[model samples]
Structures are given as C-alpha cells and as structure tokens.
Target: MTDHVDVLIVGAGLSGIGAAYRLQTMSKGKTYAILESRAAAGGTWDLFRYPGIRSDSDMYTLSFPFKPWTHANAIADGEDIRRYIHDTAHENKIDQHIRFGHRVTRASWSSDDAQWTVDASTDDGPVTITASFLYLCSGYYNYDQGYTPEFPGLEDFEGEVVHPQFWTDDVDYEGKEVVVIGSGATAVTLIPSMAGSTKHVTMLQRSPTYITALPQGDPIAGFLRKILPGGIAHRLTRIKNAAIAIGFYVFSQRFPQQASKFLIGRARKSLPADFDPKHLTPTYNPWDQRLCIVPNGDLFRTLRSGKASIVTDRIARFTKTGIDLESGEHLDADLVVTATGLQVVAFGQIAVEVDGRKIDSHETYVYKGMMFSGIPNFAWCVGYTNASWTLRADLTSQYVCRLINHMDARGYAFGMPDPAGASGDAAPLLNLQSGYVQRVAGILPQQGSSSPWTIRQNWFLDAWDNRRADLDEAMVWTRQREVARAG
Candidate 1:
C-alpha cells in the first residue's frame, strides 16, 4: 500500500505514449502513472515480432507530432506500428493511466523530501512508488535481449535458432532455409520479409549496409491527405518528411564522396544484371550505420527475383546444416536468424539513487539530451541518431513540457543539471557507430563541451536549442527547505 504520483511514467512505448500525452496535456494538476514493463503497448513496436517488423524511420518522421500518422504507409508494418500505439493509448484517456506489469525496479532521489521513490516490478509483488517527476520513457535498448554473438559452431546448429527479438507464433518460416545474420536495420528487414515465406532468404553480412529504395506510399502524403485538413495534412507531411530527412542527413555528412556514389548508383539501378551491385554497398559513410530502407524496391526485388540472397562474408562457424564462410563458403541453413543487434539497455535496467549515492550513468553529464548532470527531477528520451526517432521524440516531449511548466511557475522543488563544473567535452551520448552503439559505449551518458551540455543531433539544432531555451541557464532550482512549522 504505497503508491503516489505527480508524474512517474517509465515506458508505455513510443516514448511512453508520448510521455503520457505531454504529462496530461501540459502538467495540469499532475498525477501520472504509465509503468509498463510490457503487458503490451508497443515499445519497439511491441518488442518486434520479427519477419519484416518495419519502420526504420519514415512514419512521417516516425509519428507523434501530436498524432496524425493517418497511415498510407510511409513504411509502416509491425502491425501498423502496433495499431498506432493502441490508438494513441485509446484516444488520450491514455489507456487508463497504464500500469501493465509494472517493472521499474529502483529510483531513489530525496533532497530532504523533494520526492521520487519508485520500485515497481509486479505480478502482485514489490510495488512502492512515490513521485513528483521522474518520467523516463524507457527506450535506449535491451527489451529483454536481442544481441547474440557466440557462433563457433553454436552448439552445432542443425536448424531452428532465431532471435528477431524472440519472435514467436509457433515460429514457422514455411518452406524454411532462411539465414539472415545482420547488416543492420534488422538484416534489411529480414531479407525482404523472409523472402516471401522462406525457402530462400540469405543475407549473411559482415559489412555493407547503405541500401535505399523508399516510396512505400506517400505521393506527397497521399496528395495532402486528399485535400488538406487532417491537422493540415499532418503538418504538410511533417514538413515534407522533415525536410527530406534533414536533406539526407546533411547530404550524407557533407558529401561523402558524392554520398557514396549516390548510394552505389542507387544499388546499381536496383540490382540484377548479374547481381553484384557491390553487395549493395557500405563501408561507413551514409549516416555511417543506418540506411537500409527498402519499401518499393523491396530488397532489390528480393535480389532480382532469385528469391533473395547477399553474402558479403565472415562467419566461419555454426555448421550442422548452415554457415561456415570464412572464405570456404557453405551456407545451407534451415533457419538461423541472429539479426545481430541491440542491447544498449540504458534505463529499463533501472537502479538510480542520489541521496544514497549510486548514480554513475557513466559518471553523469548529458543535459539537454534530456537531463542528467547531477540528476534531480529526472528525465530521459534520447532520439535521433541522424533523424526521425519521432523527430527527437517530438522535441523531447516539447522540452519536457517546458521543464514542467517552468517548475510550476518558479516555486520549484528540484530541477538539476548545473554543469557549472563542466568537463565532458562532448561526443559519446550516441554519435552512433552502432554495434549496439559500440556495445554500450562505456555505460552511456557524457555529452558536453558546449551548449546546454551538448547533444544536438540536429532537428534544426534541436529546434533552436531545445525549443527556445532559457529556463534559467543550465537549470538548478530547488526549494523544499521549510520545516519549522511544528511550533
């Protein structure tokens, strides 16, 4: 019997249902909930259900500029983005303040009663909670494992061994044969959705990622949603697909050899002609580690209709029926999918303290990338490693509802991030080199050496520095210091 809130939220998916619709439409009378350790509510589109689980950014900037992704496929899938996050948490009732299987696991913070207790993890077990701000939107990876790399004869394979994040449904790749190792974006979206029900889908990969095709419906956002209106045709198709994904990530980082020869001459005019389009290109450069999207060319028409395939090389093991190519080549497979990625578990692994110490999120720093420094009222979002992670999660939920309405109009209670003693010379809080962000870049957090603790993966410089800054430079606020009223 210990539950309270003014804002708790920790992951109801898609940035915890858009941070509970911006803390119930801008902090009015507070009182939040949203625990969700998955009983459902599409976090990673309901923890990816394998075979073509889509959206590698392109649901018009990955949705949530206050909804309006009236789908017409701008590369959707994953059950229509988990039924548009269960219809945006049941049309804003926010699905009765969520709670699904709880699971927070720890969060102390005190400052002599400035609140925040938390503990979660439930099936009718450990509960305790208390809050006054702590929203994390649990995302930066590890939704119960999905990065497996052991293969030295992986227990002599002999078929069936998948891991598209534990995909089930009595796992059946129909005619089977599959292979799919990883080149990123879930092995080019499971080699064209498991090459039309398997019997042939290879992929393998050791290097080479940049592939592109796009156009899974969006003729100018379906002709401005049939003559404008639906929120101005979703804000002019989210500002023309966020200015064409920020002009193709600043023209492939300022023209990397003419953007890798215009993405290997558009994958050699969409493959076939003896295949070879240099194994669909990539050796870094082109968002350096993410650029797969295959909407219309559908993985070069499943590798020019030979069903599907693409080797690249480097495996040397796991062979009871499949894989062995350290240049001897084997590849037989009945099923082996280890779309090799993801495991950067930043926050869902909870545990944070403060009064009792234990904070060390890589010796804390990150601020505008959504609060951290010395952590106080707390906040967490982390989106955009080039573009469209809900376009910096809708500007970090509108700058965390303008820093909780400017700490309740200045009466304050806690706020943090006073990096006055700064010393993290920026560049680490995910500048993506991906292999699950360089295997947990020394336990995350640390981006400074400039503006509001630096981390601008540009959404127009985080909308002119986190939606027009100036909430008392680098914040600090306090005020729970009055206790002599017992006279």
Candidate 2:
C-alpha cells in the first residue's frame, strides 16, 4: 500500500531523527513519516563497525537540545553513541514514526501537485510514497560504497582485505599484522582499538594529519550539570566549547605561527622528546581538512602499551606476502584495512527537479549552505568538520521548521530559492581538495563568498543566524508565493 504524509524524512540518522523530533514537537496538526533504509536507526552508529569507531567531537553539541548527553567523556564510543541515538528516538517517541528498511532510491518532484514522489526499495519490495516536504538527512558518507584503493597485485596478497565501512564480525585478526591504510579519523581510531587484539597495526599514510587530544570529561560541565537543570547545563557547555573554538580560529587568522605553535607545541610536549615531528606534525594549516580527536589520550595509551606503530610511506603494490612500500620495505599482514575515507554525496544521491527540468546538483550553488539555489520544499543536512555536526544540523532543522510554519500559516504549498536572476559573477561552491568536497565542487551549494552561508565552520555564528534569528525577513520565504497568487 502507498502512503501520504506532510513530511517524509529520508534516513533515520542523527540529521533525519533531529528533523523528526523538531517536527513532532513544533509542527501543529502535521502528519509526518520517517523512512530509514536499514532495519535499525542511528544511521552511521548502526552501520560503521570498524575498530575504534566513535565520535571525535564532544557529545554535548552532538545530542539534541531536548536530550541530555550524560557520557562522562566529552567524546563517546560507538556503542555509547548508538545507544544515545536509540535513547533519543525512544524518549522523544519518534521511534513509532520511523519505518525502517525503507531505502529511498529515487525522489522526483511534481510541481503541479506541489509534492515529492519518492520511490523506495524496502523488504516488502518496491513502494511509492508522496509527501508535501522532503527532508534529506542522509549524510555525505556513502552507505553502500566506502573508499577502497586499487593496489596493483592486490590479488596476490594472501591476506583478507577489508574496508572499514564494510567490516564483518566474522573476520579474525588475532596475532595478525594489520595494516590500516590512510590517516583519517577512521584510521586513527582503528589503530588504538586493534593494537591489543592484533599482533601490530601499521598506519600507512602518504602524508600526516593533525591529531589532537581532548579531555574525556569536562570539568566545569560536570559541576554545572550536578547543580543546574539539564537544559541549562547543555546551553552553558555548548557556549563554552564554541568560545574556545572561536579563540583558536581568530588566532589562526591573525597570527598563523602562534596558532600553529599553540597547537603543535602541545602535541610536541605531550609525546616523547625523540618522537619524529615529520610523522606527527602535518604540513597543512589546522582545520584544512578535519582534525582527528583522541579521547583522554587513549591512542597514546595504546602506543605506550607497545602494540601499535605508525608508518609514513606510500604503497607500491600488493604481493603474495604483503604490501610493498615505495621505500622497498614489505609489511607482512594477515589482513589489510583500507580505512581510506568516504565518498560524499549531496542530498543523498536523490534526484531533484524544478519545472520539469532535472536538477544537476553539480550545476547549482548552495544558498545559505542548506537549501540549493533553486530547490523548493527541501533542505539537506550534511555534517560538520570543525564543530560538532549536530550543532549546525540542529540549527538548519530549526530554521527549516520556522520557514515551513511560516509558509503553512499563509496557505502556501512551496518555497524555492530563486538565484536565477543573480549578479552573474559567482564562483563555485568549494575551491579546496577535500576528497569528497572536491568531487561535488561545482554542483554543491554555494554560500556567499565571505559570510553566513559561505560554509564557515563556526558554531556560535551558525547558532545565532539560524537558531536565534527572527523568523521574519529571511529572504527566502512564502510571502512571495502568496503575493504571486493575488496577481
């Protein structure tokens, strides 16, 4: 049977669930349904099972506003995060609204009907649904495809080859020399977690990534939560974290050397005096890509325990014995993990159209970094790099709700970003070399060259412009739609 609803949320991940929670509470007399591709919720948490998979950022900003993240460490583990997502959904009564295993394959917009026709593949087979608003929360991380490098002579390797995104529990790596390629967050996480279980883990990366250590627990936050109400505590905690990030960011802009010194200097002091900076210190500026956070120095602890080793070398090829390095050294391994990274897709690879014209997202610019330049009745939530992802995601959700509520109040069926009649001199979305961002550079959302939506990775600024702003005069609203009706 087919279904119809006021809103159809795609993916039951944090962004999707966050949208549902806000809609349930704020949207009066609105019927909504959440469609999840997997049988379970907690999108990333439920899926990724690589060793040491967990949140690099703190839980305070990660958790919803209505929920209290009581984890002792600011950073939490995979299970802890999975449980948190499940708990948030349950406590908020959003679990019933979620129809799991509904993998959305195609979504086509019908302007005549002012709705979206979503085609999904579920266990029950193909089914179609329609909704007034379609919100995509499926993150940039591709669920079906993880990055796997094509190594020459890989077939000759006598070891099990795996990608972290597609890990299975059956594989045994005990006493095996494990080589985890790439030095992204995933690789860093896996190194420490597998050190004890495996013979040794060699993190093979061509270049270095900045790694920083954060306290497991927040000292002032611990004190406030005990005395203050949970909501108040969360607000204070979020504010404190935002301020600290801003200070570092401002310094990074004003005095690059001082900022680098403060950051790398700490790293230098923490590790052994003889530890090579060539391996530990990266060449790029801070926040160039994303910094991997090691909780309470757990990674360092694992290193001190004598089970893990970091190797800086490019892979030459795979052999019957193991991976051959460019330096002519062979690291024999029982298994190889290509913890390379993810392939990001804007709007979860769902097709969008306007006025019978299929939208080539690669062709449009990001308006406000949430809505596309010409898309209507939709807002996609991608994750963050510097601040907690949920921080920006929550803001986007709140703003969307307010925008929808305003539209509904005025009897409007849609709101679209009309960048059609522009100044004609706008640049592409991103000019960086982020593995995923670079792929969708021209097609991704374009923010203003300098401010608000230009993709600034600041939490306080995001919270203010989105969360605290007045719903009036947002530039993209249904007032134009209502006025056009009179004409």
Candidate 3:
C-alpha cells in the first residue's frame, strides 16, 4: 500500500516518458510516479532487441521537444533511442520518481473519491496505490504478447520459432536458412539484418504493404549537425519532416485513388520488373494501415546482394522443415521469424474499472485521443500512426499540463466526458483497416471517425494543438478530489 499521488503514469515508452516530462515541467509541486513493468525504462525500445532495429520515423520529429535530437542519423537506432530516453529522464530529474519492474495489472476508479486505485504487481508482489489521475501512456502496442500465428504442426517442427518482439542476441542463424514472416516494419527490418548471418534469407509476407525506402542517415542533416547547434538542427529537421508527413496525410485522405496510384507507381519503379504489384499493392486505402520504412533500401540491398528475397503467399501450415503456403509453396528454413502483426489491446490488457463495474472501453469515444468518454480523472497518450509517434505523444503531454492547470484554476475533482454528450449519432472512432485495430476496435477512444481524435492522424494538428496553442474544448478537466459519476 502506498499513499496517494497527484498523477500515475503507466508504461515507460515514448508516450509514457513524454507525459512525465510534460507533467513535471508544467505542474508545480505536483507529485508523479512512472511505473514501468520492465526492470529498466525505455518501453518498446528496451523490450525489442532484434538486429537493425530503429525508428521508422525521422529522429527530428520523434525526439522530445525539450530534448533536441542531434543524432546524425535522421532515423536513430534502438540503443541510441534508449540512451536518449534515459538522458532525458535523468536531465529532467524524472528518474527519481519512477518505479522500475512495477507492472500495473488493473486500475479501478473510485467514483466516490474521484481517484484511481491502481493495483500493480512488483517483484515483491501486488501492492495498491492510489492516484488522482491515471495517465495511460502505454502505447497501443501490446506488451505481453508478440505476433506468433499458429503454424500448423509447429510442435512437430524441429527448427526454432521466433518473434521480432522477443528477439534475443543468442539466436544464431549463422549459415542457416532463415524465413522471416510478415511484410510490415518488423519483417522488413529482419530480412536486411539477418541476411548476412544466415545462408540465405526469405521475407515471407501474405501481401504487400506500402514500402518506401530512406537512407540510414540523412546527408543534409549530417552536414547541418556539424555546422549548427543540435537544438537548431533538431528544429529544422522536425519541421521539414512534419511538412512531408502533412502532405502525404492530406493527399491520401482527400484523394484515395490518386494517392494509391502514385504509391503504386513508386513501388513499380523501386521493385523489379518481374515483381507483381497487384498482390503487393493494397486495396482498401492508403493511411488506413501503417506504412513500412526500410533504411537505405535495406531489403532492396539484401535482395541485390543475392542474400535475401521476398515471397508473397498465405502461410497455410507449418511442417518440420518450415512453413507451407496456401499456394502450394513451401519455405524451407532452419529458423522462422513471425513478424506477422501486433495485437493492439485496450489499455494494454490492463483493465480499467469504475467503482465495482469494469469500464466498457468500446462504448467510449476518445476526446483528443488522450482522454476517453465515460472514463474520468484519467488521461492516456495515443500518437499518430501515420507519422512519428512522438509528435502525438509530445502534444498529448503538453495537453495534460494544460488540463492540470484547468482543473486547478476551476476546482474540479474529476473529469470524464459527460456520457450524455457521447450518446446519439456518434460513431466508433478509428478508420484503420489493420487487424490489430480491429481486435481492439470499439474499445479505443473515438477520434470522431475522422482525425485529431475521431480522425486527425497528421502531425501538424498534433504540433499546433500541443506545442503551439491553448487546450481546446475536446478536453475535460477535473479538480483534485471530485469524481465523475459513472452510470
């Protein structure tokens, strides 16, 4: 049992850390604690240890606003990111308040007290802590499970089965055939990284996703980093990246067919003449699912080097040697890596309960994608999947600070959206077509079925609302002790 705190932020990933940084900087004398399930911080970065792992988004936009990114590599690697997070926390003195290895299992809200009762499992066992506000900085990515499709006769297979999420350093693919499944970012990253170590590598994807290539390091940023201050360079790069992201987001949303055609055209050029673009191309819409980024055409380079190749087919079953695709093709391998996809769980499978009743996440709409409808005294950070995640996270953090001030100024104990306002004609949030989004559909806060909550996935809206302006009407504020009445 622990005494109450002003704020309790779960997870230590980009979003979680961002919330802490903002809260500390914005709130005066506010007590906050960051509970990380892992032994150390660096949420996703710390958890994933696959080779060639790095940010898909540019560092300029990914880095925190207060802590400027000066790394020459426009897209930074995992270790570099972990270091940056650590440095940011330490420099800001946020490290002192974090509880490592404290995995939060359930958070229950007390309508009477207008506070949250958080039950967490630490190394010592379960302990309950109370807080006025619970900020779910836990990113949409699931922590407990990695994507591992049931390969038929997986037990019969003698080869090692692996997942990108739980990749370890010791898995030796030296001179062995490796098959990496799934075409998303994880598989794209795996093929290039394991090509050299393995005898030959095959990137097996059921269908193609939009894959655009960028260099490992930005030449322009590299030059500017040497001449200009790190902060200045960070600002320049962030803005430039944001502009590009904005253009794409708008283009895709406004002109779906046109944008898809343009993407197809680019794919044709980047890929080989023999490569089929139809199955490789998506059908629904662009920006509906996240795009994959490969550094310096890493997958292309691997293909060019004759060390790797891409196979598009449905994985029908698993045999002792490898996977059997529904197309009657079998991929023989000594090792198999399922980069299939992620499972987006609501609140990371960490339940949210109000009074004795468990909160129905699906019934709620997202207000600014940070706070939920009918969920009180709680704020969570969900970033742009279309762009750099940090861009949205940073904005969310700033928004929270404003919310705290709003609560303080007016004297409201708790704030959850008036369920009355959520009823009638409002639709379930999100327009994503990915399986992960579907798994947790209705549970996630509605962004309006459009963007910025119901629909805004662009980075510009995030920056404008978070760093550039005052808190908007979408947010609900609460006082220190008042609780929202849940129906």
Candidate 4:
C-alpha cells in the first residue's frame, strides 16, 4: 500500500501530536498524518506502568503550550499525563489523522523529486508512504526494550525480577520484601510507592543519585489558576517553572559546591537525624546525572517510618533469594525491581537512505539539535537533559512548521544544513554522563563546536533561536532537479 502527503510525522506521542498541531495551525492546508508504532497515543506514558509512575518535570512546562494543563498536581501521574496527551489529540482532531501500529522501518530521500519514501511494517503487511517533509518525533529511546545490564547468576535467582519499563499490573509485591536495584529516578519513585504495600522495600544501589523533594502541586500556580484565565495562568506557571528550573541548572553548573551542599542539606532535613547521610548524598555534583525528585519527601518519610531503606553498595551477583553485595552482605528480597536505566535509540532505530546511499548517524553532525547536517527535509525532536523535555519539543515543532512555510513561500523543495567542516572534533551530542547516554554516545551524531550546529541545553536560547533565527543562515535550500529544469 502507498500513501502520499505533504508531511509525514512519525510517532503519535507528545512531541508528534504537538508537531501535528503546529502544522495544522501555522502551516495551513498542509496534509500530514502521524504514524504511531504502538496502538495508543502516549509514548513513554503508555509504555511505563510502574507503581508511582509520574513526571520528573512539572506538567505546566511538560505539556503543550497551546493546551492548558488544568490538573491540580504539577507533578502528575503517568496515567494523567497519558490522558492529557490523548485529550490534546482528540481535542485537536489529530487522532483521526494518526495511523496506529505503523512501525516505520526505513526512510529514503530522493533529491530528484525532493521527497521521502518511508517504509513501515504493520499487522496487515508492509506499506509505503511518501512525503515532502519527514518529521521524527518518535523520541530517542527504544520502546520495545530497556537497558538491562548483564548480571552474573541472574537466572539462578528464584524470585521474580522486573524492570520498571515493563511493569505489569499482575506482578504482586504485597507484604513481601522487595529490593529495588537502582538509584535513579525510577528507583526513588518505586521505593516510596511500593513501600506502602510491601512489607519492606530496600533500595539497593551501586551509587547514590541526588534526590530532591518538591511539592506535588505548586501553590503559586494554584493561586494563579484561581485568579487568572486558564490560558494566562498556564503561561505564567510555565514561565515560572521554567525560570526556576533553568536558574537552578545554571547555578549547579556554576557553583557545584554550593548547589551540592544545598541539595544534600535538603535531603538530610527530610530524613531522620540518626539516618546516615551518605546514602542520600551523591559523589558527583548536582545536575551531573539528573536529580531525582520525590514529591513531598515521600521517599525520606518512608525511610524515616522504617517502611523503606537505602543501601549504597556494589552487587556481586544474584543469589537464590536476593542479590549478594560485594561487602559480604546479602539482601533478602521476594521480588526484585531493576529500575536501572533505559537504552537510548536514535530515530526509533529506523534506517535512513539518501538516494540509495545508507546514512550512518555517527558520520553526520546535528544541525541546531533538530535537523541533521546534509539530511534534507528531516528533523527529530530531542529535549533538554537538565530541564523539561517538552519545552524543547514545543520549540522544535514550531521551527519545523516555520521551515516548511519558508520553503513553500520561497519555492524551495529541499533544505538541509551544510556545515563548514566535518564534526570529527565536535563534542558529544548529549553532553550527559548518564549510563544510557554514555553507552550510545559513540553511535549518535556529534554537535558542532560553534553555533547553528551545537545543541544548546538552554530553553531560553532555544526558544529565541527557534522563533526568530533565519533558517537560511546555516541551511542550504535547493530546488528539485525537475522543477529547476522546467523553470
């Protein structure tokens, strides 16, 4: 089967839906359809069903700017986030344009016609879709499987071992001793949530991660919502949240000692006086790997109440009942949850070919963090590592729409970044030291040493550049051969 459209969007997740909305409003009369590999709309929200699954970033900034997030909790649950995404799609009538169960496998660009021929696998069979522009909002993580480190004697363990990425409703941990192996955001979330039902929850970690507590609902946002119009309130709240988040990130990078002290002091106050502070304090500086947020100090309160505890140690191997530590200690666990980390996959693992030539992602350079160097009519949405991801997602979508509009007005069929030099000496694309990021850093594209090619982590800069910057500055625009010949 074959279908044709002006724009072909991959993924019907938060970014994809938002991209569709931008095209609908900004680039009117443009025919576009969203291809979702999953049967549902929400991407990460739908995939993760772990206990106490919630947003690491506030919803005001995480949600689409056009849609008002009227929910009371700033830190919303996964279900709520999923519902919000679905509601946005339904409200904008974007859901009707989405073809679910379409897993895009390959995309090939033709300079002769200035079009993309996308191949996808579906339950029915293989289908081909062509479009003038290809927008990848599929995100950078693998949906089918998460990062699972090879552990010795993992198969010898008798009890159930689960990863938060594939959590199921039927996996029972009621009144049982559960040991969650990880110190990341997922571990912090699961410890407190599972502690309510489990007899005891032990958070076993290789190293401690920075844990910070914020209120579930923002009091200022709540006040604004009551006094101002829904849209006004949402905008104000988003700005406030974004400013605070950016300020903190900047402060952490500038003054690591002060930020680390402040973060450790906050964690210490949340826990009991007798509790050892080493487990809550990370060796690395703040914002080094993401700071884990637990609303209302729930994790600390759980620890203080003796329902849960944290153990920072190396895992030697898995035993019959639990994991054995390198320090000659063993944890008794009935159920083990590996909240380890995720496996990052760029562009949904889809193969890209330009005129019968396969594109190696590592060989290319990232253009303004959205589009790739020398790759025409293609852009991917990658969010900030330090702040809310949706903030960047929103900006990138708008820029894409603007680019499309610009090409249409200028009679240009192809647009791609033509970097001055190869990015062989450029910095890592992500600039993150997280396990998942480090594991795949070599495979992903590199960010240039200068502007227009280097990806900025600052939301304010990104917002400005996306909205006002001239695309022609770095991008090379061209007319299709047939069109040029006819002209």
Q: Which one wins on lDDT?
A: 4
Error of 2 at 20 (Å): 1.0
Give the higher-lDDT candidate: 1 or 2: 1
The model with the greater lDDT, 1 or 4, is 4
Residues 235-278, model 2: lDDT tens digits: 88877886776666666667866766677777666667776777
The candidate, 3 or 4, that scores higher on TM-score is 4
| Model 1 lDDT per residue over 338-379, tens place | 989888877667999988988878778787787888788888
Q: Tens digits of per-residue lDDT for model 3 on 211-291? A: 777777877776777899987877787888888876887898999999888877865677678766664587668887887
lDDT comparing candidate 1 with the true structure: 0.81
Please report, as a residue range, the 10-residue window in candidate 2 with the lowest summed lDDT.
471-480
**What does candidate 1 score on TM?**
0.35
Q: Write down the worst ten-residue block by lDDT for model 4.
A: 419-428
TM-score of each: 0.35, 0.93, 0.92, 0.98
Question: Which residue runs does candidate 4 get wrong by more than 4 Å?
Answer: 419-424, 480-487
The candidate 3 region of ten consecutive residues with least summed lDDT is 478-487
lDDT of each structure? Answer: 0.81, 0.78, 0.78, 0.90
What lDDT score goes with residue 463 in model 1? 80
Which tens-of-lDDT digit does each residue in 86-109 have in candidate 4?
Answer: 999999999999999999999999
